[model samples]
Target chain A: MTEHPGRITREDVAHVARLARLRLTDDELDLYTGQLGVILDHAADVASLDLDGVAPTAHAMAVTNVLRSDTPRPGLDRDEVLAAAPEVEQHRFRVPRILGEAP
Target chain B: MDRYQGGGVVTEGWELVIGLEVHCELRTETKLFCGCRNLFGDEPNSNVCPVCLGLPGSLPVLNQRAVELAMAIGTALHCDIRPSTFHRKNYFYPDQAKDYQISQYDEPINVDGWLDLPDGFRVRVERAHLEEDTGKTTHAGASGRIHGADYSLVDYNRSGVPLVEIVSAPDMRTAVQARAYATELRAILIASGASDGKMEEGSMRVDANVSVRRSTDATFGTRCEIKNLNSVRSLGRAIDYEAQRQVALLESGGVVEQQTRHWDEGTGRTETLRSKEEAYDYRYFREPDLVPVVPDAEWKAAVADTLGLMPAQRRARLVELLSGGNGAGGNDGDGDGDGELRVDQIATVVDLGLDDLVVGAVAAGVPATLALARTANEAATDAEAARRLDGSSYVALLTLEASGSLSATQAKVVLGDLLLAGGGDPAMLAKEKGFEAMSADSLVETVGQAVAAEPDAWARYCDGEDKLAQVFVGKVMKATRGQANGKAVVAELQRLRG
Candidate 1:
């Protein structure tokens, strides 16, 4: 029903989930594979639609030249920001090892 | 969760390709697509509204300021400001409650620009577009790991903030150049007044795409995307480390795999985060709720006008002005008063830190030269001192420097004391602090005293131990408590010793 149909498969869905850091179960991955295929296929259909004369819209706001004076306002209150974090030490946001070891 | 899941990683004679997606939060008071506050590091969930929070029944109204800032950046980067439209980039994440992000698809705000490097290489700007920011998420407990974490906390303060995403073409050859390009880009963005461009505050973020290939290969090798590279040094170092890793793998007859990588600042290395995916991953499409974005002719022209005289051009102009004796006279052509006034003007301009502001002040009936000199004199002191010196006191500083009663250096000391003494006059500070320049005659007398004090040094000087002359000069300078002109003292000593 659309161009580029079936380009995305179950493997592609799994790859995407990994990229997005989403831990999806096998059943969810299979469902997303089908759902993503349909969505991309629909996008391909839209990409193929006859709108040669239609102008592409990038922004909805018809405004321009919005500028603030070159004045530096007060920035973040350091102590106040650290208050929201569940755990903070020495003014730094503590996080576990996200990157693995070498070798 | 398994750390590695891909079938095969690319390893030997393979090159890696990279691209960058840099997003800078636009410096504006209001949100990108709404009237809610556009701020960073605010009280948790303080600057949020229904539109930003993705509440049902809330309609979107685009902030005019965000669009203008986007256009300003587009034009500055020399992008073709295509009459384009917006689309919804759909993705479901906990931080983004909207389930879809309203961003430009094929029709970005600007397209096809190049950033010229000093080394004759150019990094092409693929496109720059405007979008709203999502809230931040923090995984807490269990060593604060994203996986196996007890719970994840979300902060909505930054939600719906305006951002300009500047995507660069794969033109960077080395890690150093990529980092340089990023730095220059930040300077331009900051100068343009489009964004605060503060990396520490997370106002500006860089997503680096790095890959390496052989010198002879025409095709690019499998590339890895390195995300979360914070500072300029880290970006370049991460790229270098990743490239070396890839090259080592290739040299060892291994294959390179296409994947997204995460950079660890602590370790100064990159690790596999996830394999790269095709565009279908996000399932991007046009948002049915929002219509296409369109800017009128008048709007475009106004934005163009606002991007007037960037900081680069202003720096050049200031350099020319200083060199041409328009200010800060290096030498007067006719030996006429070397325009101490002009020197003041240059000093003022330098003190203001913003050329445009200085120019504006000059045009506003302020004696440009006097105001500038006064500004310069005040700047050389502490903030308190600068505040203490009333308008009239600055004039006294210029007069002293011009009349040769005090050198520029001494005037600064006097200004500092005046500022620190609070309620003290600069002239009185100079008199009480003995901040006066030594004249030729007084310097000679001090030099004679030093020569007499160090008879052995005088004998060393007469014996052609030329280096001892410096010792004599030092003694003379010390005797005068560094107030004497060491040059004049040296000349006087040479004559007496001979």
Candidate 2:
């Protein structure tokens, strides 16, 4: 959908903000669009590299299979965890009328 | 909807294309990233940690057993193992504490596999990727459904539980094929120890992507995803209903919209849950917390070794055993003591993990038909205990029934006791239940009375109406209090006729 690489349009900023549930003013949108544009442009500069042998990376660390055994350990107490929630009912965290899957 | 065809047939010339996404929970002791117990029906919110709750400063660590189970599942379906990474499927929902589900996108661990149904149909598996499950949310207030629910309570006990969502290519054509694919995949999941495969318990779930086209050669039409199909029966019913709905929409000169719909099992129809127009753009990005999962060759082989005989292999083994190691494999059987085991009987036995009992009983000189029948019918009634039913106990019950020492009904009663007790001496249970075999003379007297009372039927039986023999046997069984052996009754009836 990007016609120019790393070019963040105001519409793109607005769309992404809506997806992230961020209510942004027009001035803020213009500001973030420029900020995000510069950030993406800096990152997209990697595309200029000509060497093709580099493997894609998910993390900065070179670790693989950072696994733990399937063992059970006691976690946070239910009372303690529920105490931090905004609402509680019948031993569960109650939220206001949140419907089914995200649309 | 008024013109909907019966049995989910879209029109006479239309073709049904279906793809299934099955989410199965891995049978591990802890959550996918944390050490909290991965259990079902525990106290609400009991299993919670900083990592699973998406608290800041907490890092995620992969669970070794989850990866192994996923690999075993992929191997069972003939998948290619590869290095994979996780991404965040960003969305907002009460079920997920993170507000964004960590899932595998673009790259997954297992790919390009195929699952073969017992009837020789193969559904290509596109990918099987690991992810974390979400919390349980129960809607509050009127209707209990989301339509009018005032609030919803969330339990994070299920949060971060390990799940592998298997996406299949849209290869299925008929509703029957979709059901069969689910069934066969469930069996494989259980056999490979990847999951418990209990759909009713939510260990395994299915969502069908159904579309209708004019013909098999035509391009696929827009599909509406049907969600929350909990059982194989409901999976078939939902697919049929969704197909009919799409076809009806198209025939009425209306366009089918690509959307997600919930299959209401109560209403027996698929209702729109959400449409694709407002679909969330799940901002997928790599998780910098956990590193890549690159399964080495040795570890992959070790996982493969744990995958024992799948359902198809077990069914074939039982079929070969029932044929005394010589009969060809086919389902062409009547199952009336003709020394041939029906294909469906073998499938049921194997599916319930009762093939070992059948194999054991048949090896003890019990006729294959008798062993297969009892195991497939009576033992199948209590599959949980039947799986643990000892070989000797099953053989003992079958021997008594086959040798005319106990009637079929007596064997059934004693077998029920054996199953309930988990294991017991069959003869002792029979004696304790006072199920004594009748004397031949007593049996003759009983058969004589049954024949005399059913003279009209007996007349036809004598004139070679073989089907009437079952009528007299039923009558004799009732008179003798179910202690009359069917074979002996038949022999005595023949003698009286001569």
Candidate 3:
């Protein structure tokens, strides 16, 4: 459990928006800063609960080991799959200069 | 205590600390969370579905065989299998079509395992966790570098493939030890049937974290992670180069920066990729679409049963066979006279995953030394052909050599023919190639003729200049048209001398 340090600043919102490739206006950044602050406050309230012995739950349902066999099934047709992309070249998904590089 | 000096700049007191992270793709038929075929070299975007492509309203289901193979690796590395869950590692990368990768962060499937290298050193495995592979991005530019690339192409055929990343502790002291660890781990992966261990094809990838510190320092220096180390040789070279770079920097009163470096194989140097401040935070959170995986006792035991003998165990078994005692008899007479197999020969057999071939031949009553030499030297040349070879043929070849029906050289030629062209019996091949072993009496007569003809060489041999014995053996081989066994000729010469 963790606590919210303080109000979410406009700079923080701007930084996140840039990382997400979101072209947010100054007004939008200010609005997001306020809205995100409220969400963080609410999250901190939940985190403030004194449930020391309780286990953290990852899913709401009581399911575990939901897996499929390794056998292959019919996949989407290649033409149909590529048709949905914005661009295609040599049967591949073509994109503009991929920002930095791949890891 | 090997000190690395980078760029010919001597930093004699600095010790290099290296740790490796290896990612091996599991040998599953389908994708990790979809039914798309998990294959390589297929047409781009040919093996994709809505789930793998991250289309709207598509959900992911775990692949059971991938988990089982991950557990098999854990068991082989002596890891503790635990209940694990997946998380969404959020980032902005076109390679990951979803802009987020489904991976295991905190609670991985396998934890706290250790692998023992053939050099008698052990490396602690931090975790062996499962994740989905991203797409392949091919940059197009004059330099072919991403920084100056005009555009890029993406192949989703590799996407959604299952991968298990084995992270090792910073327990390696030198580059040689690091390579040995990777080699042994690759053998274990191949032995466990978890991965094909093809680093060149990108099925198995390695990234090395290297740092240099003063020999007397109690704390570690700053480390840089070097990527693009696709081969074992590249991994070693990158670590050595990076360590020297860091050492040279420190010697000039400069601090080592925490960054990710790219290994330029052509230039044999590491260049800065990005600094820590520019690195992605990879905001991780629990993946809501998937459930936890908890393998019960029975499931673990079943996976354990499927695991074959690991490389170390196989090497030990081969050594036992080479020592000739058979674990019960008083000297079965199969040793190489020194009761030890050469380390390189053992590594060759084990690394090629052909130890079982040698073992099977020995089990069929062929001498261990003969089996080891043939497999290590001859069969190992063509690994693909060797894997398809029948154990009976291998044993037949060795048996022929052991019984003196074919000399060692002749046996190698016949074995090479069998491996390359794949037909004809060993004896038949020997006859067709004019490599038939001469009779003992014929060899005796040839040796007698050689002694009479090469009087000066035979007199030198009889005068305790034993080095001249090769002269008589060579002459006998010439007289017999290379059909006489050299060992037999030598034995006949010794008998005549007596």
Candidate 4:
């Protein structure tokens, strides 16, 4: 299979926008796609700069076990918790129809 | 969807492959990268700043405390403390003010770790990484149900909250084990002082990935992920439901699709949220605004110091401390019958946030059993002690019982009074309120009065009618507000009647 060009196109950007749930305008999508390509390309450059034996870094801080004593605390009352939700009923948050119809 | 007829339909055996991604909100006074408060509920948008809101030209400053907490959790989980990196997970959901979430991706802080289960079983932990929380969204006017009427409200109080997401390997085979694993994991987190494990308040959220395969199959089946499961019970139930759904589909000669699903805890089912996507979906890359986080050795040591006693070690210590004559302390030789507090009982006390109080009261000279009772009595009898007599007051009550100043039953009575009235001393209040036991002279006088007043009853007792013994016993006890010892009262009354 022929590898696609290194540059990320508008189509690639549109596909991502759809997945991420962003309703960007065509021009904005175009702009971000190019910008994202450049950013990824720069990251690719960093990925290339390697000392053969260098270790991969995940966390910047060298920290160890941080913990709390195992103790149960009084939780927020149901009403107090429910009061914060914009839509709530019977002590739970309510939302809208999230599922699309199945084929 | 194919409907299976009948309420209790029996199905063939299918093994479930369950994995959990637990996202716990880290306990910190401020946001992960900003000074804004990390509180859950405040006035909407009140805790926002240019830094958290991702305004132009505002650089992200990593919180030292957040990193320490992350590493603390990593160590507690037995994860390899590998060098890690943070990347911007690009996504645009309504809750996030910043389109991209600053999170650890390919290079996670913690590598492979294992959590021990009750029966020597283990849950494999894949990675534990740090990330900033997104703002909250509330659908207004609507039932908050996805399918309904009206607009939604947004709250940013939870935004920028420091969080660590622990992803586990699909090693769990049963829902019960999954629940236990989550509970144990939460217990460890709480013990480490990392998080409160308040699932209901959204501090601890779980996403379960579940699939079903033939019991003997070595290869895995397609999996469906259920998100936003807040409670342990819900996590187990959702996993079971999702796994069963997949099994049913496979049994019906259908395929199990890989998708993101939402759990409807109300109906006890899962629904598809999104389909699987390739790498280009997220388009993750290095965060330009923030520099690499290189936690030095000293910082790692400081973080290690932050870790408290882990749950397993704490449990063993508690068991040893409560164990009698086992060289673990406590006066087990007294034969007072309380050798060590049961694990369940200790767990209960911990649940009530009364661990310190129990220990304090015990140290202050209360017997184990009497502490609760004494606290009750002290609370009922003394106002000041009553104010202090919560679940922990039992410790002091135990002391009183151990000292022989109060009986177990009396301690309970005092505890009840204190729990309700909020102030009173067991001894002084009992005396002032005439709750004290009647003196011998007073009991004798009342018995004599009863004999004189009731000639028939007295004659029956004089005739040695055995039943009259009960009558005399009742009369004396009535005179003493039920505090008189029944046996003593019967004898005194019998002599007076004769």
The number of the candidate with the highest TM-score is 2
- C-alpha local distance difference test of each model: 0.65, 0.84, 0.83, 0.66
Residues B1-498 of candidate 3: C-alpha lDDT, one tens digit per residue: 112323223268888888899999999999999989998888788899988888889999999999999999999999999999999998888888888999999999999999998878999999999999999988888978888888888888888999999999999988888888888999999999999888889999999999999999999999999999888888878888888888889999999998889999999999998887633767689999999999999999999999999998888888888776432331222334443444567777888788988888789766676677778777888866787777777777776676565767778888888887664467667878887755444566678888999888888888899889999988877777777667666766887999
> Which 10 successive residues of model 2 chain B have the least lDDT summed?
B325-334
Off-target runs (Cα >4 Å) in candidate 3 are A1-7, B1-10, B325-341, B400-498
What tens digits encode model 1's per-residue C-alpha lDDT throughout B84-128? 566777665656657667787887878999776535578899999
- Return the clash pairs for model 2, or none: none
Model 3 chain B: ten consecutive residues of lowest lDDT? B1-10
Per-model TM-score on C-alpha atoms: 0.62, 0.83, 0.82, 0.68
Each model's TM-score for chain A is 0.68, 0.86, 0.83, 0.73
lDDT of 3 at B38: 90
Instruction: Give the lDDT of residue B314 in candidate 3.
Output: 86
The true-versus-predicted C-alpha distance at residue B46 of model 4, in Å, is 2.1
Order of candidate numbers by TM-score, starting with the best = 2, 3, 4, 1
Per-candidate count of clashing residue pairs (backbone under 3 Å): 24, 0, 1, 56
CA shift of B254, model 4, Å: 1.6
lDDT of 2 by residue, B130-178 (tens): 9999989898998888878899999988989999999999999888888
Residue B455's C-alpha lDDT in candidate 3?
A: 85
Ranking by DockQ: 3, 2, 4, 1
Clashes of 3: 1
Report the backbone clash tally of model 1: 24
- Better candidate by TM-score, 2 or 3: 2
In terms of docking quality, model 3 is medium
lDDT of 3 at B227: 92
Interface RMSD (Å), every candidate: 9.0, 1.5, 1.2, 9.9
